[model samples]
Target: MSKIFLALFVIILVVFFILNINFPLKKHEIYGKYVNRNFDKPICCVEAPHTEDTLILYEDKTFESKFYGAGTYILYNGINPEIELFYKDFNHSSSAIYKTYFLNGIFEKPKIMLNADMNHYYEKLD
Candidate 1:
């Protein structure tokens, strides 16, 4: 009985590890950096550290602008793909805002059209 239990535990651990490393969920399709330019450029603010604006969507539904900072993002995939990022204040104030963008094209070659900025769109880069 002890050997059987140990073997089962080992199998479970192996399966978990494999799933984590190999088979990520469909929701993880947005896990990547979407950038407008090749180089970093400041977008959110003038004093922003980065030069290029880049949006990063993680597997855990977290996001970061890199130029501004990290935040939490939500993707509502449907007939019209939508993503919203709740960005934390740069000044460390207890303030956050949600910015929505429409996701376009395939997951691999995605382009995000920002509701705030109608002029430009962010393209996914690997």
Candidate 2:
């Protein structure tokens, strides 16, 4: 009886480990928990990074973004931007810069920013 019980326990443990490895958990796949704001009209939509929450709210006459589970706002005062993006591996002191390319008309360079930059270049989906 003891031998049978030990064998059963080992089998259960092996099965559990196999299942866990076969299907690893993904980061923030649940969209309902990630809904930032409901708007009648939105300028742009943010495709959030893994394991993080993306929030873009209108404040101080500018669109500010708070990312990485942190509720700090990043100013967005430019015209229609090419895109919005964020970095999850920001090791800087509570701040970092991101640069992205935009479809600037017939011929133009990619829009760039130094620190705390968020793009507003795309139309919010209907």
Candidate 3:
């Protein structure tokens, strides 16, 4: 009887191990948490017309930009190649306001076409 009990226990343990391996634990994939805002570098728009426009990015996935006013930003990057930015008044409402932009360019400096205006280009400050 004892030998039979030991065999059953071993079989149960094997079954549990197999089941656990087949159904892996679900976990959040923290890999590549920040796609764009992972660095401490600041990207700015140095155009004299909008010299005050600056974007300071942090590793914490948060940003502070001064375009017309000071604001906070949340960056979103999933499986898609494009990164989405959500902005809010850091001193005002907590909700972010939507804007239009098709961001592109080199890593050091990024270019954005605002409201589909391809004529004017914004560059990052060194």
For each candidate, the alpha-carbon lDDT, in order, equals: 0.61, 0.33, 0.39
What lDDT does model 3 reach? Answer: 0.39
Q: Which candidate ranks first by TM-score, i.e. highest? A: 1
Task: Evaluate model 3: give its TM-score.
Answer: 0.36
**By TM-score, highest first, what's the ranking?**
1, 3, 2
Candidate 2 clashes between residue pairs 3 or more apart in a chain or in different chains: 81-120, 81-121
C-alpha RMSD of each candidate structure in angstroms: 14.6, 17.7, 16.4
Ten-residue segment with the worst summed lDDT in candidate 3?
Answer: 22-31
Return the clash pairs for model 1, or none. 40-51, 40-52, 41-51, 41-52, 42-51
Q: Any idea what lDDT model 2 has?
A: 0.33
RMSD of 3: 16.4
- Which one wins on lDDT? 1
lDDT of 2 at 32: 13
